[model samples]
Target: ARLFRSWKPQLALHAETSGKNAIVVTAAADLDGAVRDIVKSAFGHAGQKCSAASLAIVEASVYDDERFLERLADAVRSVRVGDSTDLDTTMGPLIAPASGNLLRAFTTLDDGESWLVEPNQIGDCLWTPGVKLGVQPNSWFHFAECFGPVLGLMRADDLEQAITLQNATLFGLTAGLQSLDPVEIARWTDRVEAGNLYVNRPITGAIVRRQPFGGWKRSVMGPAAKAGGPNYVLTMGRWTDSFPNCATSSTSEVDENAQFKEYATAWAEHFAVEHDPSGLAAESNVFRYVPLYRPVIVLVGEGANRDDVERCRLAAKVAGVTMIVSRDDEADLLERLLTIRPSKVRVLGTTSDAIYARCDELGIPVDDTPVTSVGRLELLHWTREQAVSETRHRYGNVRVRR
Candidate 1:
């Protein structure tokens, strides 16, 4: 309270989080009633905080609800405006005289609409009655976020449009919606991108202890705001480890019927020889590898040697490499190659011949180094080693290998 008092004439108190999250205040009720509650609660704090509702979107259905609007207007009018020290005072004076000027600016906007609550005076503080009524969507009053006792009301065409306008603001800290329809309410609660999605409640009533609070977009900065749940703590830790020779081994048996299976077996055999891991023996026909920081190499070729190509693809997959192939080179391998731009190309048999011819046509130098047919043991060691290295680097020393 002392800090708030010292900061005289506050224009806005925007909530910010250390993390990249947003706080959304949704009022699932009548718009006028919802705005009334927000004004009452916020002014209760002397309108010195960011959680206060500076602008409100009233649903079109209830825009003209006279009874509701009357009650809302009465609530704002009832605020006891006086000195901060007064026990009966529901709102205190502007921290300084200049704050009165800022509050007046918001209250005096000539957007072709009348003020529901005109600014008044209580001692040195500038007091403004709360507002609840019809306003334009693009009204300057609707967009301005006055920290004091001021609320702008605009009608949304539908619930969906209401949510969209609510989220449309760059300030995504808090929003409120009012509706009794459970399905409509649930849909808004889920689709609304605000950090907090409340149902049938006031936007200012967010519980700090039980509910983690923060804003998204410009409203928030870092990640330190505590979110509800214990799992949030794990988001702050880091780990690391190393694998010596996990890829050298031998190839396993082939299942002639499974296309991917043959590929998996061949790849396992290739990497196993480069890195020797006892685990390879059990899963020689499986393609297992984790992604690393390095760009992946995907191979796309004809199905002439589908079995051999599959094996190579499996090997690449296990090594954290990407591979792509066309149904056949005749369909346009150049286009596919242009799309992939692999760091290295592994061509075999007929596919190799087709690629070499294309490379000549495109004026790309083709390396004729004899294709080394690696045994399972050699391929295994290399695959495991690369996978382990990639895991270590990509995760910033977080040990992924068991």
Candidate 2:
């Protein structure tokens, strides 16, 4: 417990942390640099990392180039694999024996795909890096998570297509693009679905604050807060307007990093904002904030601080968090709380055995924390992702009049 407590602000839960991390190599990318970095990105840690670049969606111009193909294959073959304790070993054994995913990835060559650099399995848990060519779009291997030392290469007509192919996966964790064109980079950055994106660099090895790590789609679960981010502790405590409501438009002690400050301020504004992310002509995904379960009962204990109680009221009022504040006994307030079938009873100041007894009888959870408020922390309690999807087209026709 002490060890776990030491890791404060830990993102309490990370669900479905899987990936089909893909890389796009444009024709204008530095040939040697792309090969070197892509190899490192794909095969580093024996490709066991969640952010490992398992797929490379290369532009047709470069994909068909013999020079590019040969260099990429050679790089994979050259990586040293052996005992991890050996100073010369660059790649080591898998954490466990090979699973079905790894076995199929190493042995099987699906239709329209062939091994450019076939991996030689040293044993059940050890294998040299492998690279496949002619990996068809949406192939069995394309969207699958291998989590091993194997990389698949796919061909794309252009940058747009490359981004499309990269996103054609159940997981959107990480992605990389290698190109010299700023225009292509900008377009890729805007459309790529992964949480962490790298350009002209390896996709893994995310540094704290430099790249606040999280994922999109099924890549993330639970509270969906990025690890090591400003909102990392957002879900640890119940968001309450019960402390102090003093959020300003300007940054004071909000953040030392300009980027983080922007994130916090922008999030606070989300309550009033409805932004679109779908970018579809017909469908819209407006991210907006809504109130949590209503009639939240604020049980004010007799020993509660008067200042804290005022702070709580001011917070709730300012944030528009409506809750029934009552000086009723634990049993009385709990009855009201349970009658509404709402969340647990929230007590301020000091809670007594009667409160616990009531809660025990009601079979509801309870937590106690000092009354406090920060807009960034409290606003999240009232917000969640809500995507509204609509097909603008009806049966064989557009919904709107032309």
Best by TM-score: 2
Candidate 2 RMSD to the correct structure: 13.4
**Tens digits of per-residue lDDT for model 2, 1-402:** 222222432223335378899989999887787898889988899999998999999999999899899988888888999999999999998988877988898899999999999999787778999999989998889988899899999999999899999988977788888886768866886677766667766788865544557776567654555665455675565554432223321432222243234335645575556544445554332333434444446677767765545444444454465666779865676567667744445566676666655554453334355544354554443333332222233234544411
Clashing pairs in 2: 242-312, 243-372
TM-score for each candidate, following the candidate numbering: 0.51, 0.62
**Predicted candidate 1 versus true structure: per-residue lDDT over 1-402, tens digit per residue:** 223312431211222522111112233454554545566544656655665666556665565566656666677888888766789877777666535435554446555566666656555555655563455655555555556666656667667777776666655565444564556655765455444444434455444333345544345422213333222343233211122122212242333334344335665554333232333322111113212222323344443344445455554555555555445544465675566544334444434545655543332222221222233321321121111101111113332332
Superposed Cα deviation of residue 144, candidate 2 (Å): 0.7
State each model's CA lDDT, in order.
Answer: 0.45, 0.68
